[model samples]
Target: MHRLAIALLLIGGAGTAQAAGIRCDGGLVDRGDLQIEVLDACGEPDFRDDWAAGSLPAGVVAPDVTQWTYNFGRGNLLYILRFRNGRVIGIDNDGYGFDADNTSEDCGPTDIVPGMTKYRLLSACGSPAQRDSRVVLRSSRHFRYGVAEQIRRETWIYNFGSRRLLRKVILENGRVVRIDTDNRGFD
Candidate 1:
């Protein structure tokens, strides 16, 4: 029974990894200054919704939405691509670092306040769906439902020296955070 349980866990993990939509063989392109690689492993969508369009080519499977988020200290950038038959159908980019509520303002230095978690920042300023850590701050967020139902995940630089938050970015889910982290602080 224990062995069976272990086997099931392993299978589950593998399935999840397969569903991340990370295709290593695909090409990488620069969208502005950001270079994005669309992986063949485009896994399953976070969840299926009726509002999501089903307009892909007939018989061609839709690769789950693949998300790549980058945090470049001053800004956070996210790319979500939905592919059907190996061609992109949907693409979205939410610039991080900038105030999510405002389109005019680029992300500034004042966004980071100590004691802020990924969730807290989203509550204060929305639109970030995910997050991770780097020299600056990185995170991402995605909402499959609607603006009201947006799911937010976030990560920011927690400087132990200054004991404050700085350069935060948000991404869309749990998987992106794990891949984007460089040095996670103790606290």
Candidate 2:
């Protein structure tokens, strides 16, 4: 480990702390002590772009941003990758036009029904907003202003003999009119 690595590890809080397995040399980013790496078509190069390129810019309204920003045009997409012990733990993808008002509401524990199959849940939600190896839960709320948003919720579910959804749920939101899975699945 070099001084930059050590310094980053020290500055990064213990809360985001991840195992040493994640490369801390130069490819990794230490935030709140959590080791995060963003991967895309270009491969994992040193994270160099200014944070502002995305939603959170330094000294800006956003104080907490975990990933570096990548923009090619209207197709600009922001992503966050979590690593545990140097291996990827989780990945988050966000594109432009993302807004808080249009964000997905938290399902909490009340949203899930045990022994629920992907097929069953898909029917209940009218159609799957999105699906992967994880479970899919989406909700539509119409505000008084006539504006509406579709909140896309994710829970990793497996389709095999076990055929079960994982415990935790990853929740996200998108425009109400544009509710369709972009085919982002672990498979």
Candidate 3:
């Protein structure tokens, strides 16, 4: 009987951890929360991406699985939360966005961080040795059942020379979000 009781306690503990959904700004983004609710609770994330996990037969509506990225700046790990049907389904860090690269630049005794404008980056880096810009569509049905807000987003990449060690910088909507070594080399 004692053994059975111990096993129950272990199972309950595991479930409790899983039940605790995404944590943000001193609050929890629990399951069953609508898209708008998550936004209200967590505010605007550093990045947002929407993708289709699976589709149903023709003439049938498919569920939308969206991923929202929140980067707590330089020294913090990036968090990705997955949502479906306007509710957050899971959260994982399968990808280590904070590349193991140890590159660093003083940039005038200061470091460039998220929220810095593009012009600020250009002035500090004196223009990227290589630059890339692109636009992406951000659409998902995970929005409120009766609401639709499809939009497009822009992202720009700056490579201040591949061998510089302090390689690439990612900017979205005119703000810096990430900076790391150029694992793919300058192209």
Candidate 4:
């Protein structure tokens, strides 16, 4: 009885460590799969973004990270896949999705809030009227060696026509960090 209990606990722990996989067109896309393989299995993603991560030490190269978001419709949750060096490293679920063609009518600028992922913001508010992005590097002394990290900072402006106020969203590393309201929008 003791041995059986120990084996069951080990099995449960192992299961928790495994990454979650997603099903795409009857195919299973899991961690360690190549970018092409996921594209083939899942078809084109609804939205995609690329950024860089990892510590930048002297003469060391940082890994390029790509994130692809798939929206299965209003009934299913959106899945965001992260790839590093052309291989899938993580899969995460955001909020519920909306119809691809009907996305623009789903929500408005008021729905956007801080802590929402880029995918969720896009799903809720559609595309921004204007976008600007830049990389901000900061040094960390906590590491054994001096290292610099690159953070992607983005500013998105939304024009909701003549009635609603304009919104300015600030995102850092693909997550909304702040939102500001500006003057009224134009046609």
lDDT string for model 2 (36-123, tens) is 3334222442222111212322343322223332222233333334433444443333233122233334332234454332222332
Off by over 4 Å in 2: 1-15, 18-153, 160-168, 171-187
User: lDDT of each structure?
Assistant: 0.31, 0.30, 0.49, 0.74
Candidate 1 regions off by >4 Å?
A: 1-64, 68-80, 84-86, 93-157, 163-170, 173-187
Best by TM-score: 4
Alpha carbon lDDT at 170, candidate 2: 36
- For candidate 1, what is the lDDT? 0.31
In order of appearance, the predictions have TM-scores of 0.22, 0.21, 0.38, 0.72
Name the lDDT value of residue 83 in candidate 1. Answer: 40
| Candidate 1 lDDT, 48-150, residue by residue in tens | 2122223443543323332433212134323333343344444333333333334332333344344333332443444332333222112234423321222
What global local distance difference test value does model 4 have? 0.74
> What is the TM-score of candidate 1?
0.22
Error of 2 at 99 (Å): 37
lDDT of 4 by residue, 67-182 (tens): 88877776666677888899999776665556766655656776888888897787678789999887666667753575676678899999988998999999987889899999
The pairs that clash in candidate 4 are: none
* CA error at residue 77 for candidate 4, angstroms: 2.5
Candidate 1 local Cα displacement, residue 129, angstroms: 19
Deviation (Å) of 134 in candidate 3: 18
Where model 4 places Cα greater than 4 Å from the true spot, the runs are 1-19, 52-60, 138-144, 161-165
